[model samples]
Each structure stands twice: as structure tokens, then as C-alpha cells.
Target: MVAGEKIETREERIPLWKLKLDPTNVRFSHLPGPLSDKELEDEIWKENETRDLMKSIQAAKGLIEPPFVMEGDGYYIIKEGNRRVVALRKLKEAVDNGEIDDFPASYFDKIPCEIIPKKIDPIRMDIMLAVWHVSGKKEWDALNKASHIFKMHRDKGLTYDIIAEYIGVSKSTIKRALLAYEECQRFLKKYPNDPVGIKRFTYFDEFFKKSYLVQKATVDRSFRDKFMEWLAAGKFRTHRDVRVLPDILEDTDATKELEKGTIEDALNTLYRKYPDRGDPLWETIASAVEVLRSMPRSEVKAILEDQAKRHLFSNLVSEVDTLKAELNRIRNGRSSKLK
Candidate 1:
């Protein structure tokens, strides 16, 4: 039940059998298993993350937070605690089988849940999912969160302002999420199941999140199509290479250099022509690493002395520790081989 809503609400200890997995859960669709297993998952179980939760609950002897839900059709549709519910179900089964000596029916029989009346609107339920998933505790991945907002707006006919208010994000953010998902569907149509290309979903988020990049793609369909074609064909090797596209669009000389087929040569041309135009964060980090390899001690000290810059320098020191361990392990392996 919504804590502040006027609707009827009460905490109940419901048997695990009555709590069905919300089939509409965004994460539910992506479980890696056979179709039968996937189907059974919504009705019976969960995999991956739920496994970790199952162990935690078994150790804790009970769930920490009650699942919030509303009755739907025949079962309680979980709004906030899907992972916890799945974890409890696993614990219940273990107790039934006497597989664990300590866990018994008393510990697993009925789980706490906050329930709302069955008459609540389903779209409101979607917004509740958004509150927890978008900015709240159980944050979904970028693409997952984007897809839900797009669906709610496109399919459910919710206005951007209404959705924005419900989810507590700006309308512009909602627009970017929609754009990102639309691009994902379009990209998938071409590649279908190419993991190498699909792995670039983060790049998609990075590309769309920038208002400038999206603005160019919007006004010039040809530019948008050609740029994405580069991504699908693997012409661009890294996300930074893709991210640099919008900036290149502003420079015809740079664009021509990039079209010559090497991201490095293109970026070098951009940097040389426009000395201030730098790569985004990761590229900057990579460049910083290269500089650090040959940089003077004076430069490093100056950077570390600045309070705002100390954290990354400190992180680099920790990385050096990991590198030391790796070097020692390699040396030990070689010594054993020689023996």
C-alpha cells in the first residue's frame, strides 16, 4: 500500500503461494533460461540477483522490508520488493524439503506485505515501480528505466508532465529516455542478436543523454542514419569515438578526416585543428594515464595538492598496488616453469 494514500491499507502476513511474481516487472523478461524456465520463473522462481538475496534472508532469518503490493486479478502484484519476495519463496521451498536444518515452517510460512485495495489503477502501479526503480533504492539499469518510461508514455497514454511528476524526473529526461529506447529498438532491428554491438547500449545512453547530440540527429536524418551505421558496422571502435561525432558534425574538415576510416587519425585531426576540443571522460582518463606514464614528478605533485583532484590520484595509487600483485604472480609462475 502507498503509505500516504487514502486508499484502504494494512499489513498482512500472506502465504508465499498467494504472492505471484509480477510478470510486468522489467527485469523479469531478461532472465537467461529456456522458455519453459522463463515462464515458470514468473509463477515459481527468479534467478541471478534473487539467488544472492536468498542467501542473505537465510542468514538473517527473515526479510528486512515487507513487499508493497496491490491485489490484481488473482494474485498480489508486487510493487516494490520483487527480489525479496522471490528470495522468501526460495527460503520457503528449502524449509518444505527440510534441506536446511535451522529453517522451519514457522520462519517461512507467511511473509509480511503492505497491501492496497484491488481497485487501484494499474498505471499508478507503474509510477510506483518508477519511484523505486528510477531514483529510489532499487535502481534499474539505464536502458531498463528508459524503456519503462517510454512504454508508460507511448502505450499507457500518460503525458510527459504527468509521467515526470509521477516519477520525479524532468520532462526533458523523459524525452531522452524515450529517444534512447527508440534508438535501441531501431538498432536491434538491424543487428538482431549481435552481442558485440548490443554491448554498446551504454554508448546509446551517453549519446542520447546529451541534448546537443540528439538535436543534430533530430534535424538531420541522414547524419543520424550514417552515424548509427558506423556503430552497427563497427567502424567506431569505442564509445568515445561515437561520442565525438556531434562535435565533428560542426567541423567539415574533421568530419572528412573521420570518414577516412580511423578514429585515432580523426580524433588527432580534431585535437590538432581545435586544440581545446577534448575527448569525453574515459578518453580524458586514458590520455591522463598516458601523460602520467612519462610526466614529471612536479606535475603529479601539483595535481595531488589540489583537494578536488586528490581522489583520482589516490585511486591510481591503489591500482598500482593491484599491478604489483599481478607482477609478483607472473614472476612466481615463471620461476616455477624454469624449475
Candidate 2:
């Protein structure tokens, strides 16, 4: 594509076998969760959604959603709709072999494609692809998203402003994404032989935003590595846990204090502030009050509905009243003495 020139695009039917997946598609090649690129791509073909799409194509006698393509390296590189291209190819194979009752090879032989100029602008293509995959329906996971940003800026020499403008995000956001992405890369380098999947590393992206927690983790190498181990083992979970982690790091004697026996114990230690002790009685009272303070009305009502707990609450109220009366009597005695 020529700069300042209008990109001309036209639709045509292309042979199913000729179209190939584009390696440059940052979205299509990267798969979320634990699946590798090829594994996820192969798995997409086996999905029920893919099968449904094939049946629809067979019914319509053509593919309505034309896969975008541009001529490169002697073949039409599939810029988008790689999955659809794969599905069509798979459908053609099935048809040629008469795998289904009614579908035929002739019906699956060709499909619609939107062909563009051979030399489409790489920057323009990247921007369009980024928007569709990043913000559009097909959302890439945080891992892939950061990796894409890092790659574009580092390897391709694209400026942060250019990337941010196209993706419609702030430059600072892109910077943080790159930092967190690099953090994950550092982790991969250290544990090159570990069996843990790469997707788990993106979970640390949140920590980069958390300076207090991340600082301690980074400054203290052992603590940092241990926390990353917890991450790899899938122990660090829940929004509550993430929030309290820095607190544990700041106030506690050790990070292990945060990793209590069970999840419930961990939560109680975090919420109740155990071992990271304060004024003992006040801490106990404060912990109880915190639980009550955060408890929803529905949960409070459910607890109060139980007869034993209701009786206990009434006793607590009586104790509070008695305390108030004793305090009042002491105040009256002091006043009388002064008079």
C-alpha cells in the first residue's frame, strides 16, 4: 500500500487450498490460556463452533464473511480469518472423502476472499489488526497483548505514540504493558526448564501496577522468586488475596505468614491480621468489627436468623449496655466528689 494513497480492496472467490495463514497476524498466532500456538490453532478446527460455521457455509453454498488477504511470497497470505480459512480447508477435505452424507468437494472447492494490494502498508495493517484483536470480539489475553506491544516497540521499532494512537490507548498504558511483559519474559528466562505454562506468567502483570508489593518482591530476590513460585503453583488467587499481599509484605515478619495452611486460614490471617500483631484486644475487636463492617446486610441477616447466634448477639448487646452504665456511674461519682 502507498502512503497517502487510498487502499483499494475487492472481493473474489479463491481456491481453499491456495490461501495460507499470515505469520504476521499478532492475534491469530497467539492463543490464550495454556495452549501453544499450533495446539490452539489445531484445536480451533475441532471446536463445535468451527463445525457449525462449516455447516453454514455448506448451506449458503459460499462463505459470506470473506477472509481478508494480500498477495505475498507467491501465495495469498491470509491477513485475517485464519480460522475460517482452516475450517474451509478442513471442510473441503471432509467433502472430498464424502465424510458427510450431503456435503460435496465441489461445494467446498472455493470461498469468498477480500484481496488487497500486494504491498499493503505494514504499519496500517498492524494497527487494523491490533484494534480488531485487542478491543474487538477476539480479545487476546494479557500475555499476548503485552508481548505484541513489546515486540512492536522493540523488534519492529514502532514508537509508543504510534502504537497507542492506533490501539486507542495512552502511551503510559503501553509502557506499563511492556514493563509487565518484560517481567514475564525475565521469569521465562530463569525457569526455562519448568513445566508450568507461559500463560500463568501474565498473572504477574497486576503486580507491576502494585509498587509496594512488587518493590519488595523485586528488592528481596528470594521473596520475589518464592512469590513467583506461588504464582506458578496457582496458590495466589482472588482479588482479596491480591489486595492483602502488600499489607503482609509491609507489616509481617515473613511472606510465609501470608501463605497460611488452608485458603480459609490464609484469609483469616490476612483479614484478621494474625502474627502481624497490633494491640491484642483491640486487634481482636478490630478484626471482628472489620468482618462485620464488610459483611453484606444479607449475610448479617442470615447469621442473625440462627437462634444460637442471635442469643449470642443479644448477650453482647447486654454487655455493652452494662459497660455504658458502669461508665456513667463513675462519671456521676467523680462529679459529686468535685462539687
Candidate 3:
């Protein structure tokens, strides 16, 4: 035959012994035989498809050069073309058992192939192959696939590392992106109509844990839709606009002081003296009150005295439970006299 010329009239039947499995070929053949009846594979077994597969095996008059060969002997090992080998084995067994005496001889033909034996590490193949697949993908594409896997893992309530390993990315990246996603979710929920894009999300884990606003923003549709719409409008030009409030909001003491009008009243006085003490002073007074609350009650009097000496006459440092009780007593006495 001329070089590169196709061979005309090749023999249809390949001697079962001469055919060999090739690892270099990536193509797989349809297995004709009944697949190994493992319990695990029962889901794939459809009785209705059996007749179709059988008909294909019988009616396929054209010669097919299979990519790999099945080893006839000891402990079945498929080197390559696992599907084809399985199919051929099934057909041969059925034919020999007189299940179908008359069938196409060409079904077992020598499929033109170059055999390269596969050397697999049985113990680590699944893990290693999974890793290779993950690593080989593009970063953005990997992120997409990772996101899906991460969602599945989360649905199953698994960790980021397990999902990362399953999808083949570093656990740290998964964690970071997840944090970003969660934070973005919070911001999006808070200002759903707000035009704060994902680029502006700042993940603050502690803040999220404490903020009812943050949780509400993430879950409440009224808040979330407005924030997203506003964000989409390009209202927040920088990440600062999307910045998370400080963690002091979660402080039990700070919350109580706010309720008691200490922090808010002090801030109003500060605003009367210096007009720019809006958010900054609110934060300061809240933090200072939190610090005071964090302290022991035994030390509160001394702390209050020291702070008073420093001219820090915020409502928080000045008010005492004793003084509040005394005022209540005075009010009650006045009401009795009026009666």
C-alpha cells in the first residue's frame, strides 16, 4: 500500500487473542455484554435498553475497528476501551451459550489501534485524577465549577476544604471567595436596590455575627431588593460606601447604653458643640460605653470618677443606677404630695 493510503478490504474478524488494549487512545467503545452486575451500577441498568443494545450488536453490518482488546484470562482487567471490551464479552458469551446463534462475525473485528499500556496508581487514582482535573482548568472556569461544587457541599453542610479538594482548588481560595460571597450577600440584602457591586463587598466575619442589620439585609427582600437596585445604579462609587459598621453594635453593654439614652444623648450634646460628631461620635461613644460595660461593676465607680476628671461627661459616664433610683423616689414623693 502507498504511504498514507488507506487499506481497502481489511479482514472483518479480529482473532480474539491478537487484539490488545491501548492506553494512548482516549476513545471508548460501547460494551455489548451485560455489564458487571455490581449493586452500585444497578441504577444504570435499564431493562428497556437491553433490546436496543442487542439489536445494534446484531444489525451493525459495517466493520468497527475497536480501540482496545479484552484480556481473555485470569482476573478480568480492562487496560483500555473498557466499554467496548465489556460489550464484546457480553456478545461472545451470549453467542456461545446459543442465546443468539446467528450474528454478524464482523462484530469482533480488529479495531485499528496503537496500544499503550495504562499504569494507574490504584490507591490514589481517584484523588489524584480529581486534583489534576481541578488544577488544569482556567481560573474563572475553575471558580465557576468550584462555586457549583461549593453549593452542593453547603447543601450537604460540608466544609469548604472538602468541596475545594473535591473540585481541586486550594482551600484558602475557596474560603476567601466564600467569605466574599457571604459578605456580598449581606450587603446586597441590606441595600437590595442599592448599586453596590460585588467588587465593593468587604467581608467582616465578626461584624456579620453581631449585626441584626446584616442578617436582616441578607434575608429580608424589602431590604435586599432595594440595595441591589441601588447598587446596580452605580450609587456606591467606592468600597468605603459599602464598608461594614464596627463590631460594637453587637456589644450588649453598648446596646443597653443606647437604650438608656446615654450614648445617643451624649452624641446629641456633642453635635450641639461640634456639628461633625454624627457617625464618628456615635461610634466613639458606643465603643467607650462598651468598654465600660466590659469592665467589672466594682471598678465602674472608679472608672467613672477618672473619666469625669478628664471632662468626659458623656451621659454614659455620668449616669448611675443609684442616681436613677433616687430620681424615681423623688418623682414618686412629688406625685403623692400632688394627690
Full-model lDDT for every candidate: 0.74, 0.69, 0.44
Ranking by TM-score: 1, 2, 3
Those runs of model 1 whose alpha carbons end farther than 4 Å from true positions after fitting are 1-5, 28-48, 72-74, 96-99, 196-201, 236-241, 247-339
Best by TM-score: 1
lDDT of 2 at 91: 71
Better of 2 and 3 by TM-score: 2
- Candidate 2 versus truth, CA RMSD in Å, comes to 10.9
Steric collisions counted per model: 0, 2, 30
Off by more than 4 A, model 3 = 1-161, 164-214, 217-219, 244-339
Report the lDDT tens digits of candidate 3 across residue range 1-339.
111222232223345435433331112111234333332123222333533444565567322434322333432233333334435545665766778667654444434432322343322322232343345431223333334333444544656665565555677666655654565656655655543333334323332333465576667747545444444555434434333222223445543433354444433444454443457766676677677669776665664568663454455346756678899999999999999
Ranking by lDDT: 1, 2, 3
Cα lDDT tens digits for candidate 2, 1-339: 222356788998887767877665554333344544456457667767777887787777667778889876666888778777777777777777778657654876777889987776776676666776665676666776777777778877889888887777889778878877676666777766545546544556777667787677667868667766666555665424555566665645434545544333454555555543534777787788788789888877966688887888788789989999999999999999999
Question: After superposition, which runs of candidate 2 have C-alpha atoms over 4 Å from their true positions?
Answer: 1-6, 25-62, 102-104, 214-226, 232-234, 237-244, 250-254, 259-265, 272-339
**How far out, in Å, is residue 87 in model 2?**
1.6
Candidate 1 per-residue lDDT, tens place, 1-339, comes to 332354566899887777766666675444444334236455435456778888888888888878888776666777678778877766777788888779656777788899976776767667777888897888998877987887788888989998888678999888878877777677777767656644456667788866777777788877667766767666677776666776776777777876776666677777777665664765776677778799888877877688766877778789979989999999999999999
Per-candidate alpha-carbon RMSD to the true structure: 10.6, 10.9, 23.3
Candidate 2 vs candidate 3: the lDDT winner is 2
Q: Supply candidate 2's per-residue lDDT for 9.
A: 88
Instruction: Using TM-score as the measure, name the better of candidate 1 and candidate 2.
Output: 1
